[model samples]
Target: MISVYIGMGSNLDGPVAQLEQAILTLTNHTELHNIAVSPIYSSKPVGPQDQPDYANAVMRLDTKLSAIALLDLLQSVEQEQRRVRDRHWGPRTLDLDILLYGDELIDTPRLSVPHPYMLERGFVIQPLNDLSPELMLANGRRVQEHLSQLDTSDLVIIKEV
Candidate 1:
């Protein structure tokens, strides 16, 4: 089984509920199991701050599916949750991004493993640290180390949600 970390977020239509449903959806998939989720965080929108803030979190899944298959599953989940690609960084009902897949580094037209922006986004980094501080990347960098390199002072965890 390959270990994959996914970042989930939403800004529209009860973000927290959507995230919970997404997790349930993942767990219901037979090929995926042992899902570990980080605490939910409220983050300021990345691209356009004018948009509603997003509730974000990370999930670690042990799955028998290949990277491409996992990507397909994620897309299907987004569609099930009514995610629309209206604009770049636009508001959506759900956003599921594969942050990392085992120790693999992949660059493909359909999907990129070890997500291209995993290290750069505080939303991704903070939850990653929460889930597994000692988790190491393919490049031998720890989750806590990457989080330390980021400015996450503005990121706030929403414990109640």
Candidate 2:
């Protein structure tokens, strides 16, 4: 099984409930195992501050599915949760993204592994650090080291769960 990480968030009703349900959904999948979850963090919306802040967390899973397949699974989960993608970075009921897949770097029309924005987004990096502090990036640096190099002042951990 390949070790993979997923970032999950929701700003709508019962955000924590949505996250918990999503985690259960992924674990129920026959292809995923060894599931692990990070403590949930409440964060301010990244793009449009007008919307409600979000509850976010990272999940680690050992999966037998390929990258594209895993992406498909996440999309299905979003759809099942009624996530609307009417606008870019808009508010949603659920959002999931591929953060990392083993040490493989991929760039394809359909998908990209080691999510392109992983390093740039504090929301993603912070929760990831909580889940795996010493986790190494494909480039050979630890996640906490990368997080230290970032400015997460705008991203507040309003609560922990």
TM-score of each: 0.96, 0.92
What tens digits encode model 1's per-residue C-alpha lDDT throughout 1-161?
Answer: 99899999999999989999998999889999898899999998888777898999999989889999999999999999999998999899999998889988889898887888888999999998888999988778898988889998878888532
Write candidate 2's Cα lDDT for 1-161 as tens digits: 89999999999978888898999898898899998888788788878778888988899999888999999999999999999987788889999999999988889997888898889878889989988989989889999999999887767664454
Model 2 misplaced stretches (Cα beyond 4 Å): 153-161
Kindly state the number of residue pairs that clash in model 2. Answer: 0
Candidate 1: how many backbone clashes?
0
Off by over 4 Å in 1: none
TM-score of 2: 0.92
Per-residue lDDT value at 136 in model 1: 81
What's the lDDT for all of these models? 0.90, 0.88
Worst 10 residues of 1 by lDDT: 152-161
lDDT of model 2 at position 82: 92
Give me the displacement of residue 134 in model 1, in angstroms. Answer: 0.8
Q: How far is candidate 2 from the true structure (C-alpha RMSD, Å)?
A: 1.7
